[model samples]
Target: MNKVQSDFLSLLENHRSIRHFLDKKIPDFDIRRIITAAQSVSTSSNGQAFSIINVTDQEMKKKLANYAGSQKQVEDCSNFLVFCADLFRLEQISQRLNVEMKKVLDSTEMFLIATIDATLVAQNTVVAAESLGYGIVYTGGIRNNPEKVSELLNLPYRTFPVFGICIGYPDPNRIPEKKPRLPLGAVFYQNEYPNFDEVYPYINKYDETMKEYYRNRSESKREDTWSKTITDKRKIPRRMNMKSFLEEQGYPLK
Candidate 1:
């Protein structure tokens, strides 16, 4: 990689999901730039099927905080945003242009396209926020009650809240330790995917690294390893009703 590319990557490698925030707030100009960066992300067939709702109303944010795993960060952060898969917006456009709807919003590929668009927008927004010295936390708990999130936002059909983001200045005294990740070999395959046997050694190495990380990365250290954590979490189903939720949101997802 070039020097600039390497430096940018070094920045990305230091990313952490900050849950606590200082009393400081993000500047309005920076917020606009961050969103502009999000808008710059590529979309499938230029579908641009994503929407973001900034939640600044105190009472509403608190209600959302309650729904999102009761994470105080939702209300505590300088800014909170919900990214949504928004085929409804495109559907409106198609109507204005006198287009048919049957093959557009009802197909499984259409759902995938919209969801992917929302994800890319959020990911780019993260990069932009980090570049501006802001800390961000992505709340998967937004899905803990998707129906509530949608209802609260008054989102139309063909729209789904993918996740919420909390953004603010990081508390100096509350900086979190960076968590370890799986080693490159196990995840960064080349021309072909490796079999389980070939990946076992890298898994063992990563497990050892994560064991050390969890033990020393915090004041209240825990006993855990990468492989063990994966094994434990993999067996449990999460968001099992997500399929039904999508269907209810007007994505037949067929």
Candidate 2:
């Protein structure tokens, strides 16, 4: 591979979700450039049904930090960008052109389109920001109180806050060690999905690797297996109100 390709892969491999940030500010030009890079990502059918809210105000950040389950990173980061799945823009455009879009906009397909579009753009933004020497973390906790977040940001109909990205200079002293991922074999399948029996070995191997990773990490060191950790985290029914919340937000997802 060429030097450029190798360097890019290295960057991706070295990524760590930075929660501790320095008290610094990102310049307007860099923010714009990051968005530009993010926008270059492909969207669903060119609908581009998403929007980003860059929150920099101190008071607003505090409220957002609370809404995001008291995640201090939401307030500490120089820029907390809320990536929204937005059909509101399309709705407005269709209305201006005397076209009907309400029925289609409320479809499950359109909801998927908007959600996928926002997620694609957010991933690109992460890559771009990291390339520029900034640290970043995705704050999915924003969805814990999606209604409050939408209200605070003044989000309109047919738009919902999907997730957020915290971008800023990393606190060098507190930067967490990179965590290991599942074995590729456990995730990748060829023509057909592999049988559970075949995948179990891969999972077992990964569990051992992760157990070591957890025990040796710089902070929050613990003795735990991947399966136990995942079960403990996911077995709980969290965010059960998201369906009703989305319906109220004009995404009935019919």
**Of the candidates shown, which would achieve the greatest lDDT relative to the real structure?**
2
Clashing pairs in 1: none
The best candidate in terms of TM-score: 2
Listed per candidate, the RMSD to the true structure in angstroms reads 1.5, 0.7
* Error in Å for residue 96 of model 2: 0.7
Report lDDT (CA) for all predictions: 0.90, 0.95
Cα lDDT over the full model 1:
0.90
TM-scores of all candidate predictions against the true structure: 0.95, 0.99
Model 1: what TM-score? 0.95
* Model 2 lowest lDDT segment of ten: 175-184
10 residues in a row with least lDDT, candidate 1: 213-222
- Candidate 1 — which residues are off by over 4 angstroms? 1-3
